[model samples]
Target chain A: MTEERRPFVSARTVAERAGVSRSAVSRTFTDGASVSEETRRKVLEAAGELGYHVNHLARGLRERSNIVCLVVADMTTPIRARLIDVLTRKLQAAGKVTMVINTGTDEQSVASAMRQTLNYRADATVFLSGTPSAKLIETSLANGQQVVLINRDDPLTGCHNLGVDNEMAGREAFFLLRRAGCTRLALVTSTAHTASLIERERVFVAVAEAAGLPVAVMAAGPTTYASGYESARRLFGRSDGPDGVFCVTDLLALGFMDAARHEFGLTLPDQLCLVGFDDIEEGAWESYKLTTFAQPFAEMGDHVVDLLAAPVPVIPGRRIFQPVPIWRKSIRASAL
Target chain B: MTEERRPFVSARTVAERAGVSRSAVSRTFTDGASVSEETRRKVLEAAGELGYHVNHLARGLRERSNIVCLVVADMTTPIRARLIDVLTRKLQAAGKVTMVINTGTDEQSVASAMRQTLNYRADATVFLSGTPSAKLIETSLANGQQVVLINRDDPLTGCHNLGVDNEMAGREAFFLLRRAGCTRLALVTSTAHTASLIERERVFVAVAEAAGLPVAVMAAGPTTYASGYESARRLFGRSDGPDGVFCVTDLLALGFMDAARHEFGLTLPDQLCLVGFDDIEEGAWESYKLTTFAQPFAEMGDHVVDLLAAPVPVIPGRRIFQPVPIWRKSIRASAL
Candidate 1:
């Protein structure tokens, strides 16, 4: 457009117009600095005449920007996607701007993302993944940055941790499968390095071992649909495969179900029963009808934002939630 | 935890330490400004000694932050979730930070979101929804901001638009259904206010009316699974329902498929043929196996970010994509 860059109104001009000292104009703009009511009125009038607006970047040089940084490993996941959607809405409503960083599941990427956020001098930071560097967190905490960790548990004094109760969820899955009269139970999951998955698998296997149930553990490369399908093939290929399988995630369960029914020619609820975590929209589809646990994503989002928006809690409490189980056609009716 | 805020290194300190004029220090930081190598070296040494980082907020007051604002109506939608994920990765790789805002599908909320972006002085703004305000667009354009619109068609001179060929998609749906030897046809969709949906429905209805086909237009409340199921019940409850049904989206198609099979006791691709848009992950489930059109989200995201990261295109252009139809079990084999 070839528009010329207009010169900004200086405090000197406001001072001259207001018939006050330049320090008066400066004090008027500075928050909590003393300025008489008469001088403030004169500065305000002169500033209005010149159409002068405070340079927030210049102001931010002296203070913190009302910018919150949310670092997530991935946003494409259904749970994360829904959580981010709610978070952005709530934060925006609370008059806070949020910058989202999608750091891949690698230590180097996570470290780089943390460095970038630190450079931004964000007022607060929220780690949506579990892999944030301890050194980075310590640095941010040292700088008096309020850090909130979601889906991660850490005993650090400076950060607040929020997560789902994976252990309880694991126990529920074991009992649900046993009640369905499935003597053989299995757990299907990926080797993805998420703390939530690790906890769920740990507890589920421990419970099964305690009860002396015949259980199989199938692990795959990644937590994707293809991985789920591959895990299903490896688990079900054996003659002594489990009849009831609990998938660590809904997406994996979907993949397992599709592979079992289409490629393996297995009918669900008769030959096998499957359960999944995360009652995502697809779980309720007529085709899958997956019995699953619904992550309290909406509540978690609300709580996280509330903690972030408010002053640091007195004790930096750890908030944990138990996922709710949703029943569908994937499980036998007798179990319900 | 009670660490005091460290004092920031000011340009005056650098000037004094380097034994140079304050203007010389400012010119060194200013891009493309004249500064001798000796003076630059001195300023760098002095800055290092002082552990000084350029106050980006202060610098932003003069120029713009490398911040790109992404405005989406809802990130919970599958397509948007995938798009945002790719955009975040690509933008981060390009050294640009992204702030996401979820403005609900309403004029007031969209306008408010736009205002917030402008206040942040976003170097570039990308609207992932079609409902952005025209006035806001003009103001941002006048301010020389590179604005990109995805899934929205506009004749504005300065903004680049990326979207799918909704009209062509609609026609393809009609022909595919007709080829299945289904005389009865119907289009199922929500009353949501997306330009893409509007265009798709317009063409579908026009072609059906032109061909003198008996078509039922079933409209639901929101573009949700429950809405899709409700629409299916309303459509199928009638005695003379269409044998071939086209859902505007994959989620809706899933809902209809479930309701048709379970509630109505109808089999897919036998009693009724179904075609959906957007090849979402759930569509491939063993239960549905929905035949649908897949939007090239990854390609579109790359193009959008490329446009945003690079200098504004010499001539702002419109990029339209043709969705590829994915064949599955939902539609009659004869249709292929």
Candidate 2:
């Protein structure tokens, strides 16, 4: 099956010239390995004279090529909005053409996109969302593909995971509300089954309960402003309505705020305290100045690219992060 | 040079079975050309069995492959954010790689990036920019490379041009201000020196002057929020200064609003009217429902891909445009 395709200066040719084995040729190019400087120099001189370049493709899984597949849930979501652009450019600068796979919010579709990336022979893959099944992940790894999860949890124990600390971000938001003097705090919840949203909710409830204070949480179907708008009625219908509400995302917070202000005619910072996570650009606009926490997107993006291109998997374990709180006009402190 | 490039479809290849001449085969396939239904069916059946497909590339160079380069100026800019992701997906969807060229800001860097794209064997290239060029455009038709200014203005005639209509957009802002009853108006400008800003300036001036109203326009250097923050002194410096200010971009508008409200302690929408362009996500935030206009980015992206995929040269003096006005809460209506 190995057809004599395009004949070029390859690893075998390099191995012969360097008076070394094919694996030795690969080891020389690898980031770190014990190769004496004298021997390295000899190999370099022979390669330079012969106009031979190391075939990175033959190296162990990672060094083959810089090609990385960018798998995103949606093209226009505010969360992954800027990260995708920065990551793509950064990868391209490293001589990698990002095989962008747009998986429109379906896990199955994400898996199919992953299959296409594998078939196209990508060196590494970055999943923006949707946890790849362990079996497929193992298959891809078996075929020598590196996988990195961006702003998400790593389903595989040893995979590179890069994202913000959602639990601490949630706790910080709760305190911001508590500092605002609203004690009857409520968590604006969603049953969308996303890891990020789930982590935030867990933290918000844990922080409240740990302080020996009663905390309330309500789950609404899916997550969107439209959903939050509907949740306002259901949450308020309860006997013990909330004086403060914390949404998992800024969009949902805006929906909740709109429901309280425009719908219920409840003047903001007077009747209820509201806050959100993921300080999207829109959160600071005149109408929303939504006090929210932000996961450092630009830094996270650069880290993702670097980790995927790193010499070795430097950071181990599932990365847990805390988003920095961006104090804007939305919360109106003293409501906790 | 004119090797028969694998004939699009051969009549003889089909005729050997049809028992007819090449002329008979041509008549059968040509539209409105005389051919009996029986013969037509026979010819089509032969074509199907042979697995023949029509080639759309050669008609008027329609079949000739024309490589397109898609260039972007800073991905961090909100206007260009998520744009590359969409463009790449769309371009690849059309079976084109769109040799992406990333250029630095300032005219010289952008030109170098354009040249790099040209070096990649691009027949036509598109530049996605906010600033228009100051240097006279260079044209080399012999090379078959056409310069397409995407989302920017064209200085030279016969150059491909496409962008948002800033004039009508300006008028929309004017009407919003007029309705808000702001008699005194000022425009916060940037020194980005782009064609987009120039056109917006032109439209705003035309609308304001034609309305026979008192309006003051101030131009400032630097395009970021911090830049506008530094220029806040000028806004309050002038006696009988503007009661309403329209900024060239949402970022500038945010800075101006911050300066007017937080620093100067002026109530917004009452003491000053603010309008910005791009209708960026930030514009919809709680603090600055910036009444502004937006370009249909996705539609523009789709069109750019479509135009580049088709190899046929466009008719001279032809252009396509679509501009929209997005109304938010920043500018008050009839409150002067």
DockQ of 1: 0.43
Which residue pairs of candidate 1 clash? A287-B287
User: Can you write out model 1's per-residue Cα lDDT over B115-134, one digit (the tens) per residue?
Assistant: 66766667788888746666
Against the correct fold, how does model 1 do in TM-score?
0.87
For candidate 2, the TM-score is: 0.70
lDDT of 2 by residue, A1-336 (tens): 222212324556777888877667666766797777876776776665654544323321223434577787655656665666677677766656555665655768777766656544566788886778777676566555677876666467546777678878778877887888787888887777788788888888899888766777776766666667778777877777788788988878877787777656777777787889888765675556788888777677677667776765455345555577787766675432
The alpha-carbon lDDT assigned to residue B185 of candidate 2 equals 76
For candidate 2, the per-residue lDDT at B254 reads: 77
Each prediction's DockQ against the real complex: 0.43, 0.07
What would the per-residue lDDT of candidate 2 be over residues B1-336, giving only the tens digit for each residue? Answer: 222212223457777777777667777766799988888888888865653333212211222233456667655566665566667677656755444555566677676555444333345666776332533234223235566776566555545777777777777777778778878877777877777777777777778889988667776676666556555668687677677777888778877787777777877677788888876665665555777777677887787766666555554343546567676666665533
> For each model in turn, which proportion of the native inter-chain contacts is also found?
0.55, 0.09
The model with the greatest DockQ is 1
